[model samples]
Target chain A: SQTIHQWPATLVQPVGSPLSLECTVEGTSNPNLYWYRQAAGRGLQLLFYSVGIGQISSEVPQNLSASRPQDRQFILSSKKLLLSDSGFYLCAWNGGTANTEAFFGQGTRLTVV
Target chain B: AQSVSQHNHHVILSEAASLELGCNYSYGGTVNLFWYVQYPGQHLQLLLKYFSGDPLVKGIKGFEAEFIKSKFSFNLRKPSVQWSDTAEYFCAVSSSGNTPLVFGKGTRLSVIA
Candidate 1:
């Protein structure tokens, strides 16, 4: 079975601080990875997705960025966090094909004060 | 660009009540639809999906949805909902093949026992 791991599960950081959230998949290779943010009482917003290593497609323009360093390792980063950047961040993976379902990791709740 | 619309932002129901959540999409081409559920403090999980063939798709925990292409709608249903059915439900759409999904503002279902 494939599993996705994301950390830290919760974080509290001051405004303008650097941020790094990691996600990794095990038992799968060349999977499609995605980053999503869910604001309180709002729908999820796709932040970034990667088809392969070093290939990232951003869905929206925001203060965050994503990277795929390895086949199953994805990272979401920001040079400086904004108050608006605070949300529940989720990492998901899917089979690299059409009509496939996505699997999600336990989301990270980031609070930017 | 693909976009999804979920009609209700929040719903409150009692046990054994029939449930329906409306979802619509705006994309003129081939599309895939999905329903995901998020339990409190847990990761998002796939409830069901529709890609091709049958438009009526059944998901876990007695949930089902129908994809009416003519109306560009995919609405989730349940004949009888339980207290455990209380959760956030999200509707998503992806265009054609190998595309990132677009999500709607989720519907928060609160089923009282």
Candidate 2:
């Protein structure tokens, strides 16, 4: 069975502080990884996605950046967090093949104060 | 590039009521569609998905969605929604094969008892 793990289920950081969120997948190899932000009414926003290690495609222009250093390890980082950056962040992965469903991890709720 | 749109931003319904949430995507070629649900304090879970074959796909929790390629629509339906159905729903789309999934600004379903 495949599973995803995201660290720091909840975070509280001051504005302008550095931020780092980690996500890793188990029981899967070479999966397509993704990062998303979930807000109240704005829905889920795609932040970044990686087809493989060191190959990342950013969906939006923002302060956050994503890196896939390992086949199953993904990291989301920000040099300086802003109040607007506070939200629920999610990590997901798929088989990178046809007719496959993506799996999500327990999201990280970051509150920038 | 692909985009998704969810018609309803927020909906309040009573238990046992019929429910329908509209979803549309911007892409002409082969595409995959998906629906996800997020409980108040839980991760986003896959509700259903459409890749090939039948246009209509049934999901967990007595929910379903229909895909209309001509209309570029994938609308979610529930014959009898329950109070437990009060959660946020998201619609997503992607190109066939290995491609990034794009999501919409989810619909918030609040089913009252």
Instruction: For candidate 1, write residues A33-104 as lDDT tens digits.
Output: 999999866789899999899999998898999999899999999999999998999999998875788898
Candidate closest to the true structure, highest TM-score: 1
* lDDT (10s digit) by residue, model 1, range B10-79: 9999999999999999998899899999898777899999998899999988999999999999999999
DockQ of candidate 2 against the true complex: 0.75
lDDT of 2 by residue, B1-113 (tens): 88998989999999899999999999999988999998888778899999889999998989999999999999999999999999999999989767788889999999998
Residue B85 of model 1, lDDT score: 93
What is the CAPRI rating of model 2's predicted complex?
medium
Residue pairs with clashing backbones, model 1: none
Enumerate residue pairs that collide in model 2.
none
Cα lDDT of model 2 by residue, A22-105, tens digit: 999999899999999988778888899998999999989999999999999999999999999999999999997746778999
